[model samples]
Target: MYNIQGYFEVESVNEATALLAAAPHLLVIAGGTDVLIKMHHGQIEKAELLSIRKIKSLQGVVKLEDGTILIGSLTTFTQIANDPVIKENIPVLAEAALTMGGPQIRNVATIGGNICNGATSADSASTLFALDARLKLQSNQGERVVPIQEFYLGPGKVDLKPGELLTQIIISPENYRGYGGHYIKFSMRKAMDIATLGVAVICKVKQGNILEDVRIGLGVAGPTPLRCPEAEAFARGKTISPETIAEIGKLAVKATQARTSWRASKEYREHLVEELTQRALKAAIVKAGGEAIA
Candidate 1:
């Protein structure tokens, strides 16, 4: 286990920010599921620890009057998966949250930790990307909102500034209303395994069974969770059919830049990207109250 030079439990966001500003070397911990694991593995060196778990403001789900859903940064996965507002609005996000580890891990794993981890295989990232979520970053100076899609700089890197804490995740009402979404995770095992490939799709249907709008988010197939814009554009306004879906799958493979890893070969991962994309799209369409043509 790594040595802890200092440990402070802050009860408010301002207190957390103050501590972070004063001690820039201090590591932030929300649920401590991820950070504690790293510390135990010796992946993290000795440093001060600032625990934000006691910050009351950073928990639960709020539906703002402006039609935006504000999720506290410290909200646990279990909370997200079971929150009525989240279940009714962004069902795909709830579905994704449930797949992230088992019940016990979900009870303690915070959404902020998952996003801040910046792993390509993060289950929530792709769905959050598809939902067009935004993050509220708070510092002693003030707060600023950044689109979740632009939050990742690279693997294990994020856009968070020094002393800035991720305070909330904002999901605009427009994304979830009248839209159907699906999140699919391909892994070797059914539970407690990182995704080999993750696919998220959100679709809106127009008259004539055409896809009015579609968004695709992919995980574990690139340096960061990716939005397959080309496939989305191609699928938009197109009649839902096997042929159209197949073509979109092909586009997904072309859009992804995957590398061979111990879990999967490049070619195999590419195939999964194609297959999962098609399956997710079809499921999303069906969810949108459209009939999928096999």
Candidate 2:
């Protein structure tokens, strides 16, 4: 039912990169959840498919000597949700992974493919953004590490260069250590739906009630998943309270460039941004051992 020019399965990063470098037209496929759908709709035709499912090295979670976590690109959402390391440390990513489609989709949907697809509505994007994750990209030429924020170029586009493949997601210890985080996905339905808006908040609390530092990531807010530096700046060193939380929400809205779409209007999305920002921050604050603000 689909037009395919060629199909190849690769078993290693080197093999995949070689193939990519030689055949620049080849489309990399991992879980094939998004790519196949596009193929079915004729959005993609006569495509040469390169499957990376057999690549063993690209499929697990590892903690490095430096205490940074390296998540292989092929890791499934189900794996992420159940991984002990993810739950004990960067649980916001696990929570985001769980909110993705149903169990079936989660079983095969990969973290790497999700990121490479460059969808702003991707449940994992905001969490990774809040975590300040980095991407390791490999090519036949060499490898390069890019900040996650720099990976996205626009809706449905990423900065992946020709012959380059995303290999690992890196999370430094400082990003997750002593931080409590929460992710909120606002959508039309609770299951099997893309986010109309997603907000992720992670913060460090000190002296029981003061916010030592904070990071906020918003999805479907603009051309890409965005971090609210202004809101984060406002929260740092502040005591958690209703007033502080309210102002943080307002500043979060200032970072968005929401636009009218079939899913929601710009004004409506902006409203959700402000409301959800406060809610997620409150939840994160509590998780960080701070008193709940009313």
Candidate 3:
């Protein structure tokens, strides 16, 4: 492992910002699940390390005045998965977090780290994109919010400023209503393997018939987590049926091809998008009907 000369445990956003500004080359570690692993693997050079783990205010759950749910940046996957409120209200997030890793990793991984890392195989971001979530960012300049969908410019790239820190994850509870959803992944093995592809499809049925809103997001199918807008458009306002779902899945393939950068090739991911979209959509329908979705 490389030598980290020093450690700074920052308790506030301003403190973290000042440190980051002073040491641009320093590594920021939240949960240490990714950064520490990289360091252990010698993929990273050790410099100053800023641990935001001591930032107390950044670790709880909050419900906004508008009925939105705001999970602090450091909130763990285990917290998200087990929270009754999350399960009762936005179960899709819970479902996504459940697939994140085993119990130990879940205990230490933070939602903010997952989103900001911009990994194509990141499990949490797949459903986060589908949910139209927003990110709250902070720095010495103060704080600002950005939609999660727009936060990423490319793989391993994000829009955060030099001194910025990811502070919160904001999700509107309203959009989650009547939604049937699921996150499905293809990996060599279940637990720790990087997903070959991860897919999330969340749908809200209006009047229990027409699709009111539909979101489809895929991971490892692209350079970044992104929604299949065409697939969503194709599904919206339509009645769900095997035939209609097939059409929407085709739109997923088309949308993914035009928008996403294929790490392997467009052909493989495009086809997986089609198949997974179909599977996820059907699974979501089953979830909505009070039946188990495989």
Tell me, by TM-score, which candidate is best: 2
TM-scores vs. true structure, each candidate: 0.98, 0.99, 0.91
lDDT tens digits, residues 114-223, model 2?
99999998889999999999999999999999999999999999999999999999999999999999999999998999999999999999998999999999999998
Residue 96, model 2, lDDT: 96
| Local distance difference test, each candidate | 0.91, 0.95, 0.81
Candidate 3, residues 1-294, lDDT tens digits: the string is 757878888888788888887876667899999888878888777567899998988887877777898889899999999887788877878888888889999999998898878787888988988888989988776789999888988888889888789998988977676787888987767787777778998887666556777898888766788788877877778876777888988888765533334334567667888888888888887776633333
Ranking by TM-score: 2, 1, 3
TM-score, cand. 1 vs. native? 0.98
lDDT (Cα, 0-100) at 118 in candidate 3: 78
Q: Which of candidates 2 and 3 is the stronger one according to TM-score?
A: 2
- Model 2, CA-based lDDT: 0.95
As a whole number from 0 to 100, the lDDT of residue 225 in candidate 1 is 92
RMSD of 1: 1.0
Score residue 189 of candidate 2 by CA lDDT: 96
> Which lDDT value does model 2 have at 146?
97
Measured by lDDT, the strongest candidate is 2
